[model samples]
Each structure stands twice: as C-alpha cells, then as structure tokens.
Target: MQSDADGRLTPGGGTDALFWGSLFRDLDREGSFLQLQIRQIIVSAIENGRLPLGARMPSSRDLAAVLKVSRNTIVIAYEQLIDQNFLIARERTGYFVAGLPKHIGAAAREPGGATRDDGRWTSRFAHRPSTYRNIVKPLDWQAHPYPFIFGQFDPGLFPTNDWRESARAALSVPEINNWARDLIDGDDPALIEQLQLQVLPRRGIRARSDEIMITIGAQHALYLIAKLFITPTTRIGVEEPGYPDARNIFGLLTPNVVPLRVDSGGLVLGDEFENCSLVHVTASHQCPTAVVMPLARRHALLQAAQSHGIILIEDDYDGELMPEEGELPPLMSLDRGSSVLYVGSLSKALAPGLRLGYVVAPAPVIRELRALRRLMLRHPPLNNQRVAALFIGLGHYRSHLARVGSVLLERARILDRLLPQHLPHCTWSRGAGSTHYWVSCRPGTDTVKLAELARAQGVVIEPGDVFSIDEGSARHCFRLGFSSIRTERIEAGVERLGKVITQTG
Candidate 1:
C-alpha cells in the first residue's frame, strides 16, 4: 500500500493485503488502540527493511489518511516512536527510520510456527553494570519554555573579542610546549593564586594556593569528591529538589543517598544527618529553587558537620552569576572547623565550554582528592586554566563579568515583569542572588503538561520533576532561566508559554 498524489493510501500492487494485514495483526498484539497501531506499523516496517535505516516516512497527515486514522493518532504514534528510539524526527522533514534492530527478523522466526522473544533474547545491554545513564535521560530542552538549562552562560553577551585575544596570546606563549604533559592533578600555580586572590574573597572563602585543585568543571569536581568521600553504603545528605547531576553523582557512588528537605531559608536540617557521613549543597544559589542558604543555616550546617564528623561539599557552581546584592558568605568563609570543601566554577559566569572549575578543601582532603583525580583523568587541560588565570589576573575577566552581569540584570527584570503578565496564576521568587527565578504555578496545575504545551510552541522550559526528591509534588513548579538568552527573547518566550497554559486551562 502506497500513498497517492492526493495523499491517500492506494492499495495498488500485489501482496498489498499481505503487507497491510501484517501490520494490523501486529497492532492487534499491541495494547494501545489508536497510536499504537500506527507505531506498530512503523516498527514492523523498519524491522522488515521495508523502511530502511534513515529512510524518511510519510508525513503524519498523509500517513493518517492512508491508514484511515485521525491526524492526532498519527502524531501520537510518531511521538511514541520518537520517544522509544524507533524513529528520529527532523524538525521540518518528517520522521525517518532509526537504525535497524539487531533482532526480530527472519532469523528469529521459527519454521514450525514457534516465535522467540527476540527483543529479550538479543539484548546486549541486559547484563551491563548499573550506571548513571540508566537513571537519567538526556534532558530534552526543546520541550519547554525558558528551560533553566544548568551551567549555560549567556552566549550572545559573552566577551568573545576578549576571550579570543586571551586564547591567541596563550597559544603564542613560549612555555606552551609543556602543556602536553602538564595534564595532572594540580593546575598552574599562577591560576591557583589568581583564584585565591580574585574569586575566593568575594564569597568570603579564604584559601591559599596549596588548598585549591582544578578540575574540568563543577560536575567533574563533584564526581571526584564523591569518589573520594563516598563509600558504597555511605549516607550522603543531598538537598531535596537539588541539582540532579549532584544527586546522580552521589547516587552512583553510594547507595544511601539521603534527601534533605528545603524551605525558603534553605536546607531543613534535622536529625537526618546523624548517620550521614557527607553532604552536598549548592550553598550560593540552590539549584532549581535558587534559594541561598541563610547565614544561620550555614553555621548550623557547619556545626552539624563538625559535630557529626561529616564532610560538607559546598558546590558554589554559579556563585559569581548571583545578582549584585551584598555578597553572601560562602560556607568555607564561616567554616572555622576546616570541614568544608568549597568547589567553585567559572562555567556559568564565563562559558561552560571552558570546562574550568576549582575546589578548595582542607590540606588532607585536598591531597586525597588529588590522588583520586589522578585515578580519574589525571588532570584538566592546563592551557585553558593558564589563559583563564591570565584573563582574571589582567582584569579582562572582571570586565566580561560586569558586562554579562548587566545584561543578566536587564533580562531578569524583563522576566519578572513578563512572567506576571503571561502567567498571572504563577508567582516568582527572587533568590539571594542568582541567574534564574523559581516559579511556583497555581496549585493543582500540571507542570509536565505545561512543559509539553510550551514545547509545542518552541519554548524549552525545565519542569520541576527533575529537581524534586519526591517527584509527586514537582508538577506545580518550574524554573525560568534569564541569563542564557537575550532580554527581548524573554518577553516573547514568556508570552508564548503563557498562551500554552491559558489554552490548556
């Protein structure tokens, strides 16, 4: 069966019934009635080589007409295939068959009318060791509006000329030849000194050159810390609705990942830490919720860590991106007990592509982390670190930050105004000082559906589910990032997203 010029399926060639009827039989075995039928047909076609790998499928409307079904059915079928990895959809070019399955062909068919469970039998990943990939799906950013994509800087506003100059200068350095073998646990002393002088003071963190270790980025830093501190059964307290990457890292290293609740002030520390040996916190600006840990709570956290002999991994990932309010003291600044391990990154302030971050810990822990880092990637690339240090030491870094900060403030203002107009039912909370806003929608609203609708309108928003520890309460909130896109885009994006919510309601 093929589609005619008018976009209707015509049963033309011989064996048309055999081709079409086989699809129907397969659909009968599939549970879902409407879309599943279309999906089954597509899957069978791909499996049988009728639609080869990378072959474009008919448009949804044309296929719907051919199959005597509604366009909605075809759309849902296509969406299912896209979700299940059975097909790949190009934005405007329709769907194409994905790579061929390893099984489910003539080889799996029994001549005596017996059928084998080809999918189950031929799976190569069945016994693979458990890893983070199984728990986390690559976030689909295209499906929401104002998605607070973590760790992305405002690319349009970045100081490209300044960066180019610094990079070129660094490449031209006579000592650059040593960079090939300089990939090790410690970074350049000049870079470490620059971090100690330029970055730590703003957050009230005091560290010497010997205490800081450079890593690829905050994620890499967190991974190395987890490897060093977390044992298989160690109970690590993580903030509920926290950074997923942090939680995922700790989860992979240790089975006992404790979820600590948070409120307006910050982490609600109770007796949960009695048995917990380690804690990971985004103290500067809490991820997703964007709450800055209050000074009292910071002290309480520090006291708890000291009293319990626990380690505190303070991830100041986006500290510098915090809007200009009086500087909020980092945990390390107030940490008199030498228990806080402070990790900061330039990824958010500069650009994530740089992949440069540093961790300041006690001399002992720093030594252990360095050993672990050697086991991991040996060290981060030295050239970026040297150039970044040069940029900061020469004052170019601060200038770039000032420019980006101004743009972020303007964008944040635009978002604050536009959000209320577009989403009247939602309320926005400003953090102590951060790049994004935490938006709480009206109770009983489905943020997942809201995300879907926004996605349909070309706005990528981050749903609250990724941040929630209990998953059940994540549907009423979402995060909006104002630092990455242009200020003008914020208004239009919010307006378009608002239309989705209004129409859905």
Candidate 2:
C-alpha cells in the first residue's frame, strides 16, 4: 500500500489491501511484538466503533502486506482476539468484530464529561503530605550526559543474564506451587532462609527466623516500626542531616521529633539521646553525607542509648556493598540488650524498583510488625521473594555485588582524581566505599541555582539542603553520585560542571 496526498494509506492498484492503514500509522514498532500491536489496534478500533459490530476485518495476508509485517503475525493476532471474544473468525472468510459486553460498549460509546462538585477536597483531607519537601530527581536522568544522582542504578551494571536465570527458575512447576499461595502475616520461608544463610552474616547479624520479617522496602519497615512504637508524645531523635523519609515518617506520628547533631563520625552521642525515647540512625553510611560511623562512635552511641534507656532503629542501607576495609559491624550485631532494630535493603546494590527489604528485631517486635503489615498489604509479593531467594541461593547475588562494587569503586576513584583538578574551591567528604560524595562548594555558592544551570549543560547534581532540617546548614553544599555515570564521561562531565560553577559564582 502507498499513502495518498492526505497521508492516508491507499492500495497500490489493488483493492484487496484495506484502507485501514491509517490506524497503524502511529504503531509503536520498536516497543513490543508486532502481533500484540496488531491485536491492540484492532481491539481499540472495535471498542471505539471505528470498526462497527459485524464489520469485516482485512484478510491476514493483505493486512500484513500493507503493514509490512509477516502474514503469520496478523493470523496469530486474529486468532488470539477470536479466543478473547473481541473478534470472530470464519473458516473461509475474514474476521468480524464481535459484540462487546454491555458495559464496555456503553462506556466506549459515551462521551467523557467532568464531574460537577464543590472544591472541598482540601477541607476533607486529614493531612497534607504534599506540603512536605522531598528529595526529587529528574525522571529523565538517564537521558543526561552526566547523571550524578544518588540511589539510581547503572543500567550497564545490572546482571541481566543472572536475574533472568533466577526469574525463569522461579516459574517452574514446583517453584510456582511454593509461592502461588497467600501467606497471611508470613514471608516466604525460602527468602527468610536465604537471608539467614547468605545475607546477614556479613554484618555479623545472627537472628532466628521468627525475628525477621520481609517488607516491601526499608521505607515500609520504617513505617511499620513507627506505627507500632511512635505516639504523638513520643520523643524521636533523628540525625540532623539524616534520611528525609525517616524524618517525615516519624513526624507524621509525633511532634517531638528532635534533630541530633552529626560530625565526621555519625550521630553525636549527647544530651539529645537523653530526652528522646526512640532514635533513628544510619550506622553504616549516613544518607546524603555518606559518613561511616566509626567503631568507637558506634560503641559510644550504643552505650548512650543503653544509658538513656532508648530504642535505636538502625538503617544499614548500602552497607553490604562496603569495601572490606570500610566494613564495620552493625549495631544489631553488637546489641546484647536488644536495643537496636536493624533495617536493611537490596535497593542500594540491587535495583530500587525491586523494593525488597527486611527488618531484624526481637521476635515479639517482628510478630507485631507482621500483624500490622498483614492489615496493610498481607505480605510482599511471594513471587518476587522466591526470585530473590533463588538469586541469592544460586550465588548470583554475591557475584553481582562483587562486580558492581568493583565498577563503583573505579568510578569513585575517577571522581576523586577529577574533583581536585576541576573544582578546587569545593571541599567534600572522604567517606570510604561510598557511591556519592557530599561536597561543600565555596562560601555563598547557591548549589540549587548551580544545579539548575549545570543541568542545562547536561550535568545533574543533587543539592544537599533537602537532607538537613536546617536548610542554612547545607545551602552551599551538594552531592555528586558516581554510581550511574559512565567512567569515561566522568572527567568531561565534571569539567563542564566546574566551568558552570565558576561562571555562576
């Protein structure tokens, strides 16, 4: 078929080719299979009455020739549509549009109209979570030349083959039987077993299966912990430049959330611990700052918590990816009095979209959390749990971590070399084995503005002010993440960013 003057398809001197080629003009040929695309087009046309009920469809061969797809593609699409009751096939004749269900046909035929109502949604809402400040990253970060964004994956480093192998293994008959059922208030035993055997020992954590509960993510674990423990009057101490989500979660329940100071070590042990009943700390690597808590500091924080009779929530995010020299035992591993509740996730090393995390606490605490979780979500998807379990059990998890760690280490080293030459006016944190650097630009430098200008030049960096409760403290600071950027592009991207900073300053 060939297009006429009005951009509609016309048959090339043959009436056999259908003029319906206008429908497939905008087809997304690159996205999915041609067969599925054909089915979608036909279904949409029928539902919208463009192809009315009992309307004859183009023959598979003629339609395939017009669309430049294989004849088998159209045939399979037609057969599938016929099976689904969207189309009817005759032995010798072409397919016809099948009658749709009453609701579907009526809705498709009806014109959409806006609902009439007063604008009382704001008054009805009990809380306005949207007013809170959040750490926002560009949705198109991948399209940029330099995406120095934190907690995002490098597509190149993902273990595609290994993950696929595990996913395929999880789909087997026996594996499906194991994970297909609902487990109210319970996790996949295989995942729990894998966590106990292959995961927790690295952090010196040893816990019974009863003491562990799988969560949708670390945020979910924190939410459950907060719901179970936090009251409006409870005093919760959080690190000054700590995780924003944790701060926000606690703030939702209590007005007595206190900001604890952080130095070169981690959360400073002081009078702040004395007043707060609960404290949240990122022991392994502090968020935004990427500061690793020292052994002495970790010991001091634990002692202070004990002396003050305070419970501690330790979020050990990205700790598993720490270099051998930089690795420190988690607070949960050292707690003899059961004062620490440890939260860990595969998000930092694995993909964030997976949203798999676990909470390790006392048995009673875990039991309560499980009950609370059941009320909310029943349980994290069992299939994902099974796949993760298989991924770990097959030894792919450790190997993937090793490979990713090597790449990140190399990228970090590149940033280490490039930053001094390009941006000498800025000082940065020297947290070993960190995927990002917390940088303090020259005095009076507005990093938020700098970031905006830098983005115009294809460089992306995160401002540090959002991490701090007191915005003035981090006004001149920013964070540079090396995880998602390519190694060769690092030097040029940094050089460009330095020029922007200089010109803007």
Candidate 3:
C-alpha cells in the first residue's frame, strides 16, 4: 500500500492487496518452507527501496488476509525482520520500513542507487573541517594477543549486571514517563540532577542545573563551545601536545588556533595565555603526558583566565579513573568566577561506545548550548540519559569507578615493575592517578618505529606523535595504556613491546 504524506500507510483496498500480491508473486512456492520464502521476499523489498522508509506495512491480520496465509506465519516472519534491522516496529504505530542499507537483503536494484543531482558539488561548503589523523589501531584489535591502547575499558570489568539493572529501572513505566519524550533543555533533568549530586562532587564541583548541559559526549560539547565562542578573529589557545581531536574542532572553526607550550607542570600559563580569548587545557591528567597540573598552577591558571578575561576549557580526561591516592580536585571547583568550562566523559570510566558526557559551564553558556542542541539532535537519546541517571542514583557509578581504580592501579604496578626491567635505557613519565603511562624514550629513539615493531610482535601500543602539533608529533614519546589489556597479558605485552623498544633504540 502507498503511504500518506506523513509516511502512514493506509489500507487502500486494491493497491494494498495488489502490492502484497506482487511481493508474494516472486516468492518461491516450491521452497522448502513457506514462511521463509515470505520473509525473504519482504527483506528483499525493504533493501531494494521498494518499501520506502517509514512506509508502514499492513496489519499482520490484514497482510495475512490479503496473502491467503495464516496470521501466525506472517507474524513470525515480521518478528524475525524486526530482530534484524530490515524493519522497525513502533509501539502502537505498527510495522514500518527501517531504511536498511542498500547492500543488505537483496541484490542491488541498479549500480550506485542514486546518481549525482548536481555536478561537481564540492565547490560549496560552509566551512571545511580539519583532517583529524588519529592514532590508527587495527580493526582486529580485540583479537590481538596484547593491546595497550589508551582510554578503553576492560570488557570483563564492565558492570554488566549493574548496568542492566539500571537500564531495567529506567525502562519502568514511571521512569519511562520521565525521559521518553523530548525536553526543551535537550538534557534529562534526572541526569543533570544525578551529575550535580554524584559525579561532580567527587571532582569537588558544585553546579546548578542551569550551569550544566548533557551532550552526546565531550566531543559534541567541545563542538558546541567552539561554535559559540570561536571565530576567525578570536584567538584561542590549546595545549601544544594537546588532544588532536580538540585541535581539529577548533581548526574547523578558526584559523587562529594557537598551540600553547606544556611543561611538566601542564599548560605553560603566562603572558602567552593572556592574549587568547579562550584556552583549552586538560589540567587534570593532561592528555598524552598524563601530568596532573599542580594545585598552585591551577590557582595561577584561574588567576590568569580571570585577569585576562580568557575562558578556559578543561577537558577532564580520565580524571575519574584516579588510583587509591594522589589526585587533585578539578579546576572547576577552584574557579570562583566561573571562568572555566569543564568537560567530563563516561567513555573513559564506563564504556567508550556509550557516548555519554557532560559540560559544566556558566548558566549563560548552557542556555546558548540548549538552543544549539535543539538544532542538532534535540538532546542525545533520552533513554541513555535516563539509564545513566539511574546508574548513578543506584550507586553503581561510584562503585564502578572504585572497581576500575583498583584494576588500573594493579595494571600500573605491573607496567612499573616490567618496563624498567625490560627497557632499562628508556625513561618514562610517572604521572599518578591515570590509566596510561606517558613514556619518554631516548633522544633519537622514535617511538613510532617502536610501536610498529611492537605491533608486528602481536602487541599493540600508541605512538605519541599525534599528541604534538608544534614539534611534528613528538617522536621520542609514546602512551601505553592498561585500561583494556588483561592483567595476565600485561607482563607478556610489555615484555614483547620492551624488546621492540630496546631493539629500535
């Protein structure tokens, strides 16, 4: 049946009957099973775009009546289709075409489904984004014997039961009523409340609902901030050996991207920072370097930002995965005038695929973000927000963090003992309360070569070149993570990796 303008299919007697008839006509009557043939036909129709997106299908009873088949057969076929991505079943709206990819369920209707509308369309664009060259990991990273990749969670340690429980709680009728619909503010109020109550307190931050905004993740939060604050005329400062992703975001917005030098103490805040309109600093557990900015320096940075009227963007990378001791409070807690905007993520702590993070800023900034968010995605899936909130309210968030802390500390100790013994000539950074170790190699020992050699030996590690912009991807340094690697494999992984480092050195 053809759909109305709203994509609602109406049971137009002749057309609807004939449409199903044509679809079923091609079905193999001599096939081993009748239901399987019908399922294949429907799958083919969806993939070929014969049944367009959101074009509703007839009711099971109606389709069955038209096709001269038992309702049970049609029902089973539809359920299987829904299980796959070929179709989607709305709660009350009935079955609909899910807009599955052209490659699935059927052979191509024709080569390259849609031809070009306008020739050579590359001539126009609002702003061309910067090319982000991330540290490339193999697609089969999981199958590898050793993986020392950073900012990942060990799947074994994931709070599966706890997360499932929280999800169940969120899915209940009362909680479903809370987050099932869209919000004007583009964030779950319960989530904001939980963040204010549970997550931020550990960082020593106290923020009102007006001052907080839940984003798709920290990456999205950075994009919103850059979109609002950065312009061609604005001078923005980022750590020299900073996050390449953040640098890429700012690069897309403005050409005046200043790479600020970072010493062992963290972003070298001085007269250099005073000239910029906004500065992005990862003070707590500096990216790649893993250096925690000293409390004295944190105060000085706030003083500088306050004095110069420079807004600071602090990406609290891995700030939540701190070990048993030696961790500093977030800079946001110390910002009396609210000059700092803090970005925190669940990706590091919980799971990267979850794509949940939040931004803590002044009330005015959050208000602007709400409008921007409404325009772009209308608030990350409320279901995820609700699940995260329930996770926090149930005390799983803290307990999960504690579990991760213990796991990481033991891994860190494993690396500490093995790295020095294996690669005796190399020196490394001893940054505390982080998941990875930022190792500095000998003067000419390019860690990139070492990383490649290590990979060949069935070990995976990150080369520290992408971390630096000024010195062309710092060749002498590399980041080694234990977050995803198993404790048992830690020794062998480092042993093989250290042999590569020593041989290359």
Candidate 4:
C-alpha cells in the first residue's frame, strides 16, 4: 500500500480497511467505545515499534479528523497512552513515543499465563509497586498558608554569588586529574585540611586527616555504615522520634532494631545497651524535637558505648547550622575512648544539592569504609569536592554559614511569634539552633489529617507520625520547616496550616 506524506495510507490502499477491521475486532471483543479502540491501536503500535522512539504522534485534532471520531475520544486515548508509558508529552511540544521496555526470554512466561514458571517460585520483589515516591507536593507559598517541609534550608540567605565564583574558579583550573578517577577515600588535601583545622575544632572533635573519608552525602555515609555494622539479626538502637530516613535504612538492612526513647535531654539510654552493639543518635540537635544533648547524658552515652564495646554512629546532620552561643559539644568530641564514628554533612549548612559529607572514623574503620566507597560509586564528583574544599579553605564557607545562621535564626523567631496568633491552642518549643520547629498540637488533633487538608489547600507539611517510633503520640504533634520559604510566606503558611488543624479538630 502506498502511504501519504503524513504516513497514513491512501483511501484506495488497504490501510483504511485494515484500520476499520482492527477497530471492529477490538470493539466486538471488548465492547469498548472508539477511544478504547484508539488506545489499543496506539499501544500495539508502540509495542511493535511501528511508532519508534522519540517519534511524534498525531495531534488529537488531526487524529480525530482522520479517524472520524470526537476530539474528546482522541484526547482520552492520548491520556491513556501517556499514563501507560506508551507515549510522552513535552511541555509545549506534542506527544512522542516513549522508550520501550526490555524484552525477556520465553522461559519467563509460563503456559498458565503467569510471568513465572510457578507461582511458588516468584521473585521476592514481584509484588512491589513500580512507581516512584513523590517526595513533595506542589506548594503555593502565599495562598495555601501553612508549610511544614522537613530539611528546608533558607535559599534567600545562601551565598549564591560566592559559591558560583568558587565553582568557576575550580572549573577553570588547568589541571583536572582527580576528575578522571574517584577519590573513594576523599584524599583531597584541601578538604582534609579544612576538616581537621576548621570543622573539627569548631565542633570540639579532634581528628586528623587520615581518619576522615568523604562520601556522596550523609545518606550514603549512613548506608555504608549499615553495610559494615548491621546484619539480619544484629541488634541496633536508633533515637526515638528521630530522622525517618535513617530508621528506614536500618530497618531494611537489619531485623533487630531497638527503639531507644528520646526525651528533652536527648537519647534515653538505659539497660538496652547490653543487647545492642550499634547505636545511632543525633547528638547536636535531635531531629523532630530539636533538643540538644546535655553534657551529663553525652558523657553517659560515651561511657555506655565504651564499657560495652559498642559503636556509636553520631549523625551530626545539621550540626553546622547551630547558633554560636548555646551549641553543645558533639558526642564524638566527648568520646575520649575513640568509640564514636562521627558523620557530618553540609546538606543543611550549605545546600542538600551539594551532596558533600565526611565521616571521621578510626584508622581501621576508615580502611573498610574506603573499600566500600570504591565498591559503591568509586567516589563523589571530584570537581565538586575540590570546589567545596576551596570554598571552605578560602573562608567563604564560614562567611556563608554565618549568613545562613543569622537568616534562619530570624526566621525561627518569626515562626515562633506568628504560630501562636494563628494556632493559639498549639504550643511550640524554642529550638536550640536549627531550621525546623516541633509543635505540639491541641489535645485531640490529628496531624496526619491536618497534613492532608494542608496539602489539599496547596501547602506541604510533614506529619509527626513519620518521626515517632512510639504509636499514639504523633497524632498530637507535627514538625514545621521554616528554612526554605520567604519570610513573608511564613506567617501566611502557618495561618493556612492553623485553619486546617482547626477544621480537622
């Protein structure tokens, strides 16, 4: 059959007859309308590679005109194709054929029509959904009101210009040897110097360059630690009402996870230490609660770890953002026995996009971590690390941090003042030095439902249940992130969130 310029066969050709026959067959078999038939046609075309990758499909109007069907039917057909991954739509451009899935062997399909030979021999991950988790919903800073996003750093305060200049300088360097290979152990001299001379002393941890190993970020660092320390039956202790991602990671790695209660003083360690070998805690500022670990408890934790020969993984995730005056000493610094493996990151201090973090471990542990780092992705991007080191070495990092601290401190104060006006029944505690505020809701409030209502109104807030290890407590509490949004939006976001709480209650 001779095809026209638009790839459609002429009326005299067999194309029209074939199309009509296929449509009739599909309609007779499924009793579906024209839209469903069109959908099946497009799907079959994609599957058979007749509509190749990146090839633009006919527009709804054009397809409807050609097929003598309603435009709405074509639109619905296109929508189904987009949803099924048979087609992709660019923002302004029209829809195009999406990439095809990999082909499997015939053995994968059984005579009974099952993908596997036997249902009893199914893959462990067969039942899991193949959809990506949406991290954040679309947020309207002004209209929707209450915003409680976690790990949000104030963008207005970051030294964007200085960082750009630093990055440019690092890129402009004539010699770029490290870029070719991964510095798994992160042996960049400048970065090591900054860690030893600048960061460690500031945090009261005394560590040499040989003890530090850089990773992609704190998440990666935590993952490597889990791989090294945890096994299926290994007992691990994590702080109660702690970072959810950390809990999830540990849970996936090991079966025996002990939930240590966290109070105003930080991790409440009792006789549980006898059964646990590895403990994870945010000593600088406990997440969700924002409580600083007191000196007595810090010493007690170090002592417990030392006496039991346990390894304490100190996650100082947001330690650098603490205010100058009242910041407590890191647990690693308090460890005179060298039992703590300190993990620090620049995600909150600088930006999460940076993906820069360092682990200060003992000499032996550093060797094992380096091997694992090599096995993972080799190392983090060398140029990025080099620039980060340069930024830190040139005093720009400290200046930027000072700027961030001042801005977030001011924002925190604003949140404290405005939250009461909108949410009078809700009570907020003063944070030691961080971007978030942990608020206690009214006696009978449901934080999850409140979060849902806030999302419906176009604001994204994290419910307290994700952080709490104990049940029933999260219903009355939720965390508010004040770092990312503008100062003007803070009051309004809180106001909207307050309305959701009031209505839900």
The TM-score of predicted model 3 comes to 0.80
Tens digit of per-residue lDDT, candidate 4, span 262-370: 8888899888855698989888778778778888888988998899988999999878674746778888877889889999987667877788888999988988988
lDDT per residue, candidate 1, 1-505, as tens digits? 5554644334534455455555555454334477766676677777766656666566777666556667888788888898988888888656776856556555433354566675765585633344332223225552344544444655577787888777787787564874545656767777888888887776767787778899898889898888887888899999887887788888777779998888887778888865689888877788778877788888888998899998888888778765577547888888889888888888778887888888899888788988898887778888887788778888887887777777777877677677778989777666756887778887887777877677778776667876866776766887777666566667778888888878877
Residue ranges of candidate 4 with Cα displaced over 4 Å = 1-122, 126-146, 173-175, 182-186
lDDT of each: 0.75, 0.86, 0.83, 0.75
RMSD from true fold, candidate 2 = 3.7
**What lDDT does candidate 4 reach at residue 147?**
49
Note the clash tally of each candidate.
Answer: 7, 0, 1, 3
Candidate number achieving the greatest TM-score relative to the actual structure: 2
TM-score of 1: 0.72
Candidate 1 weakest lDDT stretch, 10 residues:
129-138
Query: C-alpha displacement of 338 in model 3, angstroms?
Result: 1.7
Which lDDT tens digits does candidate 2 get at residues 1-505?
3434643333344552545667787777676688988888888887887766666777787788788888998899989999999888778755777867768887889876466343567778766788876788999999999999888878898898999999999999999999999998999999999999989987799999999999998999999999999999999999989788899999999999999998888888878778999999987777878888998888888888888889999998777774746667889998888899999997777888999999999999999999999999999999999999999999999999889888888888888899999998888885776788899998888889999999999999998888899887887999898888988899999999999988987
- What's the residue-level lDDT of 478 in candidate 1? 79
* RMSD (Cα, Å) of model 1: 12.7
Where does candidate 1 clash, by residue pair? Answer: 144-459, 144-460, 144-461, 145-459, 145-460, 145-461, 241-467
RMSD of each: 12.7, 3.7, 8.9, 10.3
Model 3 segments beyond 4 Å from truth? 1-119, 125-130, 471-473
Candidate 1 segments whose C-alpha is farther than 4 A from its true place: 1-150
> Model 2, residue 275: what's the lDDT?
93
What tens digits encode model 3's per-residue C-alpha lDDT throughout 1-505? Answer: 6667896666657887887788788766555577898888887777777786677888899888887778998899889888987788888868888875545534456655466744355556565453466667677778888988987657888999999999999889998898888686568888889989998988899999999998877899999999989888888998988898898888888888888988888899767788999999988888878888899999999998998899999999788785547788888989997799999987778888899988999889999988988888778989999999999999999999888788888888888899889878777765678788888888877777787788889898888888888544587888888888999998888878878876775
